[model samples]
Target: MNYQLSLTVAICFGLLVLLGYFLPDFDLLILLRAEILRWAAILSGVAMFVGIISLLKVHFNKFMDQKSNWGYSLVLVLTFLITFGAGVFSFIFPQAEGLVDFMFRYVQVPVESTLAALLAVLLLVAGMRMVRYRRDWTTWLFLAISLIMLIGLVTIEAPIPDVFPFLRDWLLTVPVVAGARGILIGLALGAIITGLRIFTGADQPYGE
Candidate 1:
């Protein structure tokens, strides 16, 4: 039954996409695409309730089984409940903007900023390691260009040659960006193929 449903949906979607691409004048196809997305978002939101239950079950199990980081599990549960409570309170008392705004600013902003900073530092370290540890001319060339660009970006009047900025712009706007975009396009194509395979039952998220 699942297979049949999947196959039917896949064929219908495949036909819609093909037809949309072929007949670009009519926007009924585009509307259909948007409608699918709208329904998908609604269904996905509904599915999150099941996800929440599953998450609680797993984390509670970890705490019950006395896992190594049970304290972390307890903290997670506490934070989840507190945030949920705040949301419910906000819904109940829509006029109480102070409490909700304070929690949003104090609790969420700092955590998000800290995570972003950590990610930036990690990326910087990875880039440095690649430049420092690699034993190749291409890597050295990349590192040299990166250093020049960074310096040029930081110091507006650093007495660098006029060509440095030009070279940096070229490196960024021409080769590096083009190569990254090409890779992204390839990755998107691969992902689409994989998703189509899954939709057609050639690949399954769950084991057969």
Candidate 2:
């Protein structure tokens, strides 16, 4: 009974959203869509809060169980608490916004950038190993493109005029852009089909 009610609501809301998007000139639908989106935003915030509580519970359990790598779980909990406390403090006292900004700019950004740099190095190493072992045209082509992009970066920054910058721009503008558009179109079609399936009761991700 509950599953049927939920499925009915899902189909109704999904169709309403699709109608709102495709029929922008309908005044009533536009208003309904706005209200639905506002409710969605509130629900999304509540979901995030629930997710945080779930995360904390899992980590706390791990820390208490003395399992392998439990020390890392403890560290995670401590970091989460500190960050949450800082955010609360900023909310209560507006003067602490600078501290929050500093933490985001220095701590968060650097950590993210460091991870990205490590990933790039790992990919480069993997590409080199693949080319060495595979001896395939595809592998060689991939490696060659990677090398060209790297060289383009270096040349663009150098103190000499070169065609690398133009070549990089052309590659990005033509092949990259075209490929990205194709991927996006495919994804949009897939999402539409999935939504249609759910709406028609052909797919019930929640339950039977």
Among the numbered candidates, top TM-score falls to 2
lDDT of 1 at 133: 79
RMSD of each: 3.2, 3.1
Instruction: List the lowest-lDDT window of 10 residues for candidate 1.
Output: 199-208
What would the per-residue lDDT of candidate 1 be over residues 96-120, giving only the tens digit for each residue?
6477678889989998999988997
> What is the lDDT for 62 in model 2?
97
- Candidate 1: where are CA atoms >4 Å away? 13-35, 131-134, 198-201, 206-208
Off-target runs (Cα >4 Å) in candidate 2 are 132-135, 151-178
Encode model 2's per-residue lDDT on 114-178: one tens digit a residue: 99889978987887788779997888777777767777778335663467667777888999899
Shift of residue 200 alpha carbon in model 2, Å = 2.4
- Using all chains and alpha carbons, the TM-scores for the candidates as numbered come to 0.77, 0.81
lDDT of 1 at 192: 86
lDDT of 1 at 75: 82
